[model samples]
Target: MLVNIELENAEDFVFIKQLLEKIKGVKSVCVKEEEEFYEDGTPKWFIDKLADYADSLEEKDMISKKDFFKFIDEEICRLNSQK
Candidate 1:
């Protein structure tokens, strides 16, 4: 079984985690900090920097989305061929 927990106070995380770990049937405890993301499950930082990335690509004469997709497709095919 797996469980996800959201704590009200960050300071209580360590104490709560230790308490849970002592339970007889508890196999393991993992901690993951919350992250902000878009509805599409994209990280907020990645989405925020996309425009900057696109602008840099455009400066290098790679302005078209079609060109980007084609490049990615070719790379995937090449990698698959190598395998």
Candidate 2:
């Protein structure tokens, strides 16, 4: 038997997929949209800036994993504050 369901969000999709997979008769549960699993598009300027920033990173500038995540959190908060 084939069944199709539309979920409200990624959380629901994940929850439902796991639940469906537990059923004994089910063979597979797959997402129909490739965009959900793949990068659709990104702004060219943002991509270029990311590439440039990556290239600028040096061995000396490397930080611990904890500090790296802290920096990311700080940057996210800073960007959010701008809005």
Candidate 3:
């Protein structure tokens, strides 16, 4: 049987994997790290939506990539602070 476990800390993976491997019926254990959508931790879906919104904008309303990233960073910081 394949079981998926989510760990709170990456450091705990090796310890957990070892423990699972000792179980009698276990076959093999595989480790897969969590996938990252973007380097800045932005979700791919959100980026796609942003791209669609930008595409719909008029030429004069479009913003530079640097400014766009600055806005995204600020938004992320603001959202994280609220939590």
Flag regions of model 3 displaced more than 4 Å: 37-83
* Candidate 1 wrongly placed segments (more than 4 Å): 39-83
Clash pairs (backbone) in predicted model 2: none
Q: Candidate 3 has which clashing residue pairs, if any?
A: none
The Cα error of candidate 2 at residue 26, in Å, is: 0.4
CA lDDT scores, all candidates in order: 0.86, 0.83, 0.89
Ranking by TM-score: 1, 3, 2
Give the lDDT of residue 46 in candidate 3. 87
By summed lDDT, the worst window of 10 consecutive residues in model 3 runs over 31-40
lDDT per residue, candidate 1, 1-83, as tens digits? 78889988999989988999999899988877687998999988897799788767745574589988999999999999998
For model 3 the local lDDT of residue 15 reads 94
Model 1 residue 69 CA deviation (Å) reads: 22
The alpha-carbon lDDT assigned to residue 56 of candidate 1 equals: 72
For candidate 2, lDDT tens digit of each residue in 1-83?
Answer: 89989776767887898899999999989896632322656656677778999999998988999999999999999999999
List, residue by residue over 1-83, the lDDT tens digit for candidate 3.
Answer: 67899888889989998999899999989877675589888978788999999889998997999999999999999999999
